[model samples]
Target: MFGDTIAAISTAWGNSGIAIVRLSGPDAWAIAQRQVRLQTGAPLKPRFARNAVLLDEAGEVIDHILVLPFRAPHSYTGEDLVELHCHGGSLAAQRCLELLISGGARMALPGEYTRRAFENGRLDLSQAEAVGALIQARSNEALRAANRTLDGELTRAVGEIYEELTALGAEIEVGLDFPEEDVPYIADESLADRLEVVRQSLADLLERCSSGVILREGIRVAIVGRPNAGKSSLLNALLKESRAIVTAIPGTTRDVIEAVLTYRGIPLRLVDTAGITENYHDEVEAIGVERARAAMKEADVCVWVIDGSEPLHQEDVDRVHELADTPHLVVLNKADLPQQISEASLTALIPASTVISVSAAEGLRLDELKESLVGLVSGTGALDTGLNASSRQVEELRGAIASVGTGLKALGDGLDQALVSGCVGDARRSLSRILGGDRDEDLLHEIFGRFCIGK
Candidate 1:
C-alpha cells in the first residue's frame, strides 16, 4: 500500500479562506508536477512553497495556487509529500483532487495518511490515536489530555513498566540456563518487591485512565423534581438558554429536554425531565413521569430540585427516599423567595446528599452550583492531569494489572520460576498491546476508523 501514491483534500469542505489538498508517496511529486505549473518553471524544491497555477487535464488554468513539497524520511508519513493550497470552496479543491487522481494518485481513505505515518515510524499507535482525540476534543481539558498523550507521556510510562518486566524475564531465563550456579538469579523477596512496584505503577495509570474516560465520555446529569419546582428554570440557568418550557400550569413539560454544557472543562449532558407526580391528568403525563424516572436511573448524578418557597410536600419527601442510594444533590430552588423549607429538614431526608440553595430564576449562586456539580462528577477541580486513555487503552492496562497481580501472587506463594516467568510474560504482552507493539489488525482498524477522511 505504501508503494502507491495517495491524495486527499486535507481541509473541511466549505467556503473558507484557503483549502489544502495533500498527496503522499513516491509518485506524489510526479503526479503534482503534472497538475501544477510553477511560476518560475523550475523543479519543486523540498520544504518550500512556490507560486503555481493548477491545471485541469484540458491544460486550462483552474486556479493560481501555492504548492509545498516535503522530502522523504523527514516529512509526515516519511514519504515524498506535496500539498496544494488553493482558494477556499469545494469546487476548486474537488477539481484539483480529481486532476491529481487522474495523474496517478489514488484517493486516500479515512485516516489513511495518519496510518501511513504510523506504519512508517513517524508516530506510535498511541500518538496516532491522539491525533484523532485532539481533533474530536470538545473542551480544553480534553485537548490538553490528548496533547499529553501525543507528546509521549503515555508511551514513556508504559515503556518503563515494559522494561522492568523484560529485565525480570531475562533474569528468570539466566536461572534456567545455569542450574548449577550458587547465586540465585533473582531472590524471591526481590522479585516480589519489583513486581509490587510495577503493580503500583499500573494502578496509578489506571486511576488516571478513570479520569480520562470521564473527561472523554462526559457525565449525564438529570434535573428532576415535582411540577412547579423550577426544574426547567434550573436547566435554563445551567445551559444559559431556555431549552425547556416553563409555565405556571403544571405538566407543561410533558417530556424530557436535554442539552450539553461544559463545567470546568468537563462536558455535562444536562437532562430536564418532566415533573414527577403520583397522579397524572392523562396517559401522556404518566408516560412523561415514567421517562423522568428512567432518566434519573441512567444519570451519573441527579440534581433533585425542590421548591424552597413551599413547605416539603409528601410527594417530594417520597421522591427523596426513592433516590436515597443515588449520588445526588438536593437543590433548593426559588431561594429568592421566602425560605419555607429548611436545609436541616432536607438533610434529614437524604443525609448523604449535598444540599445547595439557588434561585434559578435570578441566576443566584449558579456558579457555585456549577462548581459543586464539577466536584460531584470529578472529585478534582481540574480535568487535565497530564494523562489520558481511551476505553480500549484502559482495558489493556487493566489486563496488564491483572497479569501483574497474578505474577505477584505466584511469587508470594513461592511458585516455581517457570510459573512466575509465565505471568511476567503475560503482563509484558498486555502492556505491549497498549504501546502498539502488539499487531492486532482489528483493533487498529477500529481505532483509526473513527477519524475523518482527510486526517
Candidate 2:
C-alpha cells in the first residue's frame, strides 16, 4: 500500500442526499485524525463508525460527522482507510479536502484508487477494465456484457478454450518426444477433430465481436438519399424529436445531424446527412455532399431513404450502386401519402436490400424498422453481449484459430509433431493475452486515463 494518504470526494459533485470524503493508504486514518475534531468519542476503531462533531484545525465546528475505518488488508487498497459522510455541498467538500491537505493527505489522481485495487490484485485486467465499461454502458445488453466480464464469464470461457488447446499441445508434445516408444501416436482424424472443435469456438467468438463491440459502443448508422428525400424527417422519426430541419425547399439540411436513441435496448447513433444530389449551387453544400459520401463509406451500415412522396429519379438508382457493397436498407418514406413510386420498382433495383415502407412523418412502421435494425446488427451467436461478456478483452482469437487449422493440416500432411507443437504454442499465448497475461504498460495508462478523478 502507498504510504501517503489520498483523499477525494467520492460522490458526484452536485446537490444530493449526502457526499462522502474517502481516504485510503497506510496513513489514511491518521491524516483524517487532526482535521476534524472528534467531539463525541474516543479514537475511531477499525471497521467501526462513531458519531463525532467535526471541527477545523482552529477548533471551529464543521459538521456532525460519522467516521468509519478499515484496517490493512481488510480495506480497499489493502491499506488503512477512512470515510467521512459529510453534507452534500461543493464548498464543504473542498474545505474538508483542504483540511485534510493541511493535515497530511494529498489529492488522489484519476483512477488512482482503482489502480491501487489492481496493484493489490483484487481484480484481473478484464474486471478492472469492466469498471469503466459498466460506467459507460448505454444498453441492457451492454450492462449484462460488462457484468459478465466483471464476474469472469469471458474469462471462464477463454479458460475452457485454453485448457483444450493445452491438452492438444500436450498430446502433440508426447508424440514429439516418444516416437520410438511404440505407443500409438494420435492419428490425422484425431487432430482434425480437436482442431475442428477449437475452430468452431473461435469462429463463434469472432462472429460476436462485431455485435458485442457495437453494443458496448453504439452502432453507427448513416442515412443517405437525394435532396429533399426525407432524410432529416427519418432522423426525427427515429429519435422522436424535431432535432433536424424539415422543409419543402431542397437541400435545407447541408450538413449532418446526429441523435442517439435506443432501439430494442441497443443504442444507435443515427447520422442524418445532407441529401446527396448533383449540381450543388453552394460550395458548402457541395462539401457537405462529399462528406456524406464519406460517412456512408465509414458507417457500420447505411440507410437509403427513398421518398415515397416523390417520383422515381435516376439519382436514387445511381446512388444505390455507390453503397452496393455496403450493408444497407432501402427505406421507403411517406407511407401516409399517395405513393408515386411503386415498391416493386425499387425492389427490382436491389433484391437483397431490406425495404421498409415507413412514414417518417406519421411515425408509421418505425417500431418494425427498429426491429429490422436490431436484426441487422444481431448476428449468429448474438449472445456476445449476454450476461457474461468481455467487450474489452485483449486477445486476438483470429490468429489462434488460424494456427489450429495449420496444425491440423500439418498432421494431415504426415508432418512430425514439432510443427503442431509450434502452432499450439502460439495459440496458448493468444489466449493468455485475453487474460492480460502479456499486456503492455501504455495500454494500462490509456485505460486509466478515462476514469474520473477520485475514482
Candidate 3:
C-alpha cells in the first residue's frame, strides 16, 4: 500500500552544507522531471547529478539544487528514486518535503524504505536489520559485526545450515518412502557423527553470539560491594568523571548510578549500585541494598569492591559467596592505604576469582581494573569466535536441533514414517521462523519495529 510514492528528509535534519529530500517509487522520476527542465536547462542525466533550481507547482522558486536519480531495480529499495540535493538547512529540507507531499507524496514511515527493499527482494531480513545496526553501531567491533551481517555473512551461514538440514531431511524422507529397501536412514553410528558436526557448528555460532551480543547490545557490568569500599569511586574512575557521589560515609549511593564506558571500542554499561550492606536503618538505604542485589543478579559481570584498608567483613564475604556462581571479581580498593588484607588471603576466600588491587582513593591500578573488566565482559578475546548472539535465534535453533535429534532417533528405531516426518517438519518450521519465511503478521511487525526509520 506504500507504493503511492513516499518522500522524506532523507539526510540528517539540520543546518549543514547539504540536505536531501528523497523520493522513491514510480513517481520519483516524474517528480524530479517536473521540478527540472530537461531541455531549457541541461538536466541531470539518469544516475548523475546537475545543479538546478527547484520550483513549486506555481513555478515559484524554492531553492537552487543538485538533483540525482536512479532507475528502478538499480537503486536502494529496488525502485525508481530521486534525490534533491538541495541546501543543507533544515528549513529547506522541510520545505522540499512539504512541496513533495503537496505533490501527492506521503511522508515515509520509519524503516519504510528498507521495508520496501525487503518486500522487493533487494535484501533479506538480516540485511535489513543490519541497516539499523550499522547506523547505531558504537564501536569498530560492533560496526564490523553489523557490516558482516549486512553483507550477508550471517544469512549465508544460516542458509548453509538450512541447506544441510534440507538434504538430511530429504534423505530421511527417502528412507521412509521405500520401506522395502530396508535401508537405515539414520544409522546409529552415523547419527552421532552428523549431529556432532551440526551441533558443533551451532555451538561455535552460539559462542560468536556472545561476542556479537556484546558488539551489538554491549555488556552490562555492575559494580557491587560494601559501601565505603570505593564502588562509586570505581565508577567515577572508570568513566573518567565524577558521575557518582564518593563521600567517606557508607551507602552514599542509594540508587543505581550508570555510566557508559567504552573498552577496546566495546561499550560497557558500568552500573554503580548501592553498596550491599545489612546495617542501614533508613528505608532508602534498604531499598538501595535490595536494588544492588537485583542488579548483581542481572549483570553479565559483577565487580566486588573490598576495602584494602579494612579487615574483610563477613558482609563482604557473604556477598562474594552469593555471586560465586556468577561472573565476579574481588577488587581490593584503597590499595594506596596500608594493606589490611593480603592477596593470598583474598584469593583463598574467593578461589579462582581474579583479584585486582586498586586505589579509588589515589586512582591506582584502574588500568588493570579496566583490562580485567573487559576480559570478564567479552572474555580475553572471544569476539573473534563467531557467536550466534541473538538469544531468540539461539533458542529457536536449539528447539529445531532437538527436533532433528528426535527424528534421527526415531529413524534409528525404525519408527512409523509419519512420526519421523512430523518431527522433521517441526524442525524445518523453526528454521523458517529464523529466515522470516511464512512469518505471522505480528512477528514481522515486531521484528521490523526494532529497526530505525530510513533503514
Candidate 4:
C-alpha cells in the first residue's frame, strides 16, 4: 500500500480561487510530468513552481495549472512529491485529478499520505496524530494544544522518559549478568529511587491527561430544565443566534439542538434538550423528555435552568434531586422580570451545585455564566497551559505508569533482578510505542483513520 504513487485533492472541494491536488510516492514526479505540458518545454525543477497546461488522457487541455515539485528526502512524505494548483471549481480539479489517475497515480486513502510520511520517517506517530487534531480543532485552545503536540512537545517528553528507562534497564541487565558479584552493577536502593522518579514523571503526565483530553475533545454541556424554562433561549444567547425556536409554547424543543462555541478558548458543545415535564402532550413529547434525560446523563456538565419569575415548583425540586450527583449548575433564568425565587432558597435546594442568575431572553449576565461554566470544567485552569493528549496517548501513558509501579513494587518486595528488569522493559516499550518506535499496525490504522485524505 505504501509503494504505489497516490494522489488526492489536498484542498477542500468547492468554488474558490484555487485548489491543490497533491501527489506523492516514488512515481509522483513521472505521473505529474505525464499530465502537464510545461510552458518552457523543459524539465521541471525541484522545489520550483512552473506554469503548465494540464492535459487529459485524450490530450485535451483540462486546465491551466501551476506545478510545484519536491525532491526525495526533502518532501513532506520523504518521497518525490508534486502539487497541482488549478482552478478551484470541481470541474477543473476533477478533470485534472482524472488525468493524473489515468497517468498512473491512484486515489489516496484517508490519511494515507500522512501514514506514508510516518512510514518514511518524515514524522513520528504522535506528530502524525497531531495533524488530524489540528484539522479537527474547534477552538483556539484546541488548535494551540494540537500545535504543541505537532511541535514535538509530547514526543520530546516521552523520549526523555524512554531514555531514562533504557538507561535503568541497562543497569539492571548488567546486575542480572553477574549474580555472583558481591556488589551489584546498580545498588537496590539507587535503582528503586530512579524507578520512583520515572514513576513520578509518568504520574505528572497522567495528571495532565484529563485536561488534555478535554482540550482535544470539547466538553458536552446539556441544558436541561422544566417546560418553558428558557432552555432554547439560553442556547440562542450562547450561540449568539436564534438556533432554536423560542416561543411561549412549553414543548417548543421536542429534541436536542446542539451547537459548538468556545468559552474562554475552551470548546463547549451546548445541547438544548426538550424541557423535562411530568405531563406529556403526546408520544413525541414523552420521547423528547426521555432523550433529555439521556443527554443530561451523557453530558460532562449540565446547566439546570429554572424560571426565576415563577415560584419554585415540585418539578424543579424533583429535577434538582435527580441531578444531585451529576456535575451541574443552577441557572435562574428570566432575571429581567421580578424575582420570585430567592437565591438562598435555590442554593439550599442544590447546595452542591453553583447557582447563577441570568436572563436568557435579555442576554443578561451571560459572560459571568460562561466564566462559571469554564470554572466548572477546568478545576485548576490547566487548559491555559496548552497541553493536549489523545485517548490512545493517555492509555499508553497509564500503561507505562502501571509498569513502573509494578517494578517499584518488585524492588520493594526484594524480587529478582530479572523480574525488576522485565517490568522496566515493559514500561520502556509502552513509552516507545507512543512515538512509533514499537510497531502496532492496528493501532496505527486506528490513529490515522480519523484523518481526511491528502493530509
Question: 2 or 4: which has the higher lDDT?
Answer: 4
**Candidate 4: segments with Cα more than 4 A from true spot:** 58-60, 180-192, 207-212, 314-325, 406-423
TM-score of every prediction relative to native: 0.91, 0.91, 0.91, 0.89
Give the alpha-carbon lDDT of every model.
0.87, 0.78, 0.77, 0.87
In terms of lDDT, which candidate is stronger, 2 or 3? 2
* Ranking of candidates on lDDT, top first: 4, 1, 2, 3
Q: What does candidate 2's lDDT look like per residue over 1-455, in tens digits? A: 46688998888997777778889887887777876667565777888887765678778888777788898778766677898888888877777878877777889888877777776776666677777778878878788777877788667777889999899888877776777565436666777788889989877766655455667776789998888888998899888889999998989988888889986557888999988877898899998899898889888789999888788887787777667787788899998999988778788877777888899989999998877776776655474455333444523677788788888788789777788889888888877776667767786787677788777
True-vs-predicted CA distance for residue 364, candidate 1, Å? 2.3
Worst 10 residues of 4 by lDDT: 378-387
Model 4: per-residue Cα lDDT at residue 430: 85
Model 4 agreement with the true structure over 328-399: per-residue lDDT tens digits: 888999999999997788898878778899998789999998888877777674775655778888898999
Q: Estimate, for each residue in 262-286, the C-alpha lDDT of model 3 and write its tens digit.
A: 7766788899999887788799999
Each candidate: RMSD = 2.6, 2.7, 2.6, 2.8
Can you tell me which runs of candidate 2 are displaced by over 4 Å?
A: 1-3, 38-43, 181-186, 205-211, 381-395, 409-416
Best by TM-score: 3
